[model samples]
Target: MKKIKVGIIFGGKSAEHEVSLQSAKNIVDAIDKDKYEVTLIGIDKQGSWHLNDQSSYLLNAENPKLIQLNKSNDNVAIIPGSENNQMIHASNGTGLDKLDVVFPIVHGTLGEDGSLQGMLRLANIPFVGPSVLSSAICMDKDIAKRLLQSAGIHVAKGLVYTSANKGTISYEKAAAKLGTPMFIKPANQGSSVGVSKVKTKKEFEQALALAFDYDNKVVVEESIIGREIECAVLGNENPKASLPGEILPQTEFYSYESKYIDEKGAELAIPADLPEDTTKQIQQVAIAAFETLQCEGLARVDFFLTEDGKIYVNEVNTLPGFTKISMYPKLWEISGLSYSDLISELLDLAMKRFEKNNRLKNTVWDD
Candidate 1:
């Protein structure tokens, strides 16, 4: 049996660039070699695409601290809507071997935000995760919340503001509406970049300025006092929710420092220490949220469980972290799926969705 050729795309022009590289590394290490042949496509923080050995420059060959695209390597462009979907070499104009599928390990902006998925759709290729619509919808916090709220799910009370509305909406008005100790974050960023806990009028103004650096639209939500819980959902048609996991952050909130920096900044409790009833309710709400978003492939649904037992759906990450220590894989691991097996399942689900989609009629005009 011939192994499928998988183009594992990593790195991107997003705040989560380094984290995406780490995810691509894990996928590279865990994907079954017996079943798949992988190629590395590295995109720089500036969004330049490169192929193969040339990508080594993006990271130190020995130890890499940041994701830097390999400048020495050749360049490849993915031209969708072509008979063959692939990255062609620029040197001799030779087309690289065709790709069976693309595993976009790109996080946040270009990767997770639906731009890459839209290209894949035009190319008529089967890439992993949700479709372009779902990806785009889930990428925007404002739209995601609206859709989830319409579905009757409990969400944090907040307001989405653009940079133009910064001064027009006074800090006093915002604080009055949402209260103090709120969280101000960029609408389109992930990994807690441009996210701040605004405890006072001064902090709110400063946080708004900082968030505007990353995105034009910012979200301000009242900070709910609760335990941070996360659940991983997988599959396309019949998605399954993994056992809940709790995050104990070492800070006042789960900021960037708690997520990546400070070695002892956070702790994870798999199959979270919750009462049976609470656990079941969280699981049920998680599935509801997943279905509400029309998500496929996988997602990590985060929540805030109040002391009185109220659960609030925070946000859904379509492309959650895949680092060996990430919550997505950890939850699956506790649910009886090994890390390697989880990777295989995701790939399988992608292919399954592709096959099912191919059966739908494409042409509508009658001759």
Candidate 2:
């Protein structure tokens, strides 16, 4: 049997670029070499693509302190009008061999905001994670929360402020309506890139400006006093939610630093200490949110478990981290799936989705 060629695209023009690199490193190491031929496609900070020698780049990336993309390599590009989906030598106009599937670990901004997904769709490639519309909706905090609300899912009250519109709503009005101690963040970013917890009105303007620097839109929500619980959901249609995990961040909240930079920044308790019913309830909501947003392959659904036992759908990460200690894979590990097995499963699902899509009849046939 031929080994499937998998292109793992990582790094991007996002604040989560470093996170993406770590994820790609872990994935490249964990994927079974016998079953797949891995291609490490690095997207530099400037949005340039390059075909890196796997051993040179991925191996170097394993060193957390020294992880950085090696610049000197064959620059690549994904030609938009080509018959086969692939990366090509940018200078020579030579096509990189067609890839069986794309495992896009790029976490935020252009990478996860449906722009990359759209390009892949145009090239007719099956990539891991959600569809274009789903990616776009899930990437936008405001849009995802609104959709969750419409689906009868519990979400904190929030307001959307678009810098482009010069929105008329004042910070005082926002505080009055959503209450004090609000969480302000970029509407379309991930990994808590520009997220801030405004403890008082005095900090509102600063947080707003910081969030707007990342994106034109901002999502300000009434802060929920609860434990940070997360559930990992996998599959396309018949999805399964893994055992819930609790993130005890040493910081006031799970900021970007808590997620990646500091080793002791957070504590993760697999199969969180919750009543059996609460656990099941979170799992159900997770699967519901995954399907509700039309997510494919996998997603990490985060929720707030209040003291009163109420659950609020915080946000869904369409492409959660795959680092050694990341919660998404950690939750699944405690649920009986190994890191290697999870990677294989995602690739299989990508191929299956591609085959299924191709099987659909697109044109009218004379009967």
Q: What does candidate 2's lDDT look like per residue over 252-327, in tens digits?
A: 7898888887878898889899999999999999998998888888999999999998899999999998888789
Q: Return the TM-score for candidate 2, rounded to 2 decimals.
A: 0.96
lDDT of model 2, residue 185: 89
In model 1, the runs with Cα more than 4 Å from the true position are 54-67, 365-367
Q: RMSDs, each prediction?
A: 1.9, 1.7
Provide the overall lDDT of each model, using Cα atoms, as 2-decimal numbers. Answer: 0.84, 0.88
Model 2 misplaced regions, further than 4 Å = 58-66, 165-169
lDDT of 1 by residue, 129-183 (tens): 8888888888889899999999999899998889787778577877888888789
- Candidate 2, poorest ten consecutive residues by summed lDDT: 57-66
Model 1 lDDT, full chain set: 0.84
- Per-model TM-score versus the true fold: 0.95, 0.96
Clashing pairs in 2: none
How high a TM-score does candidate 1 get? 0.95
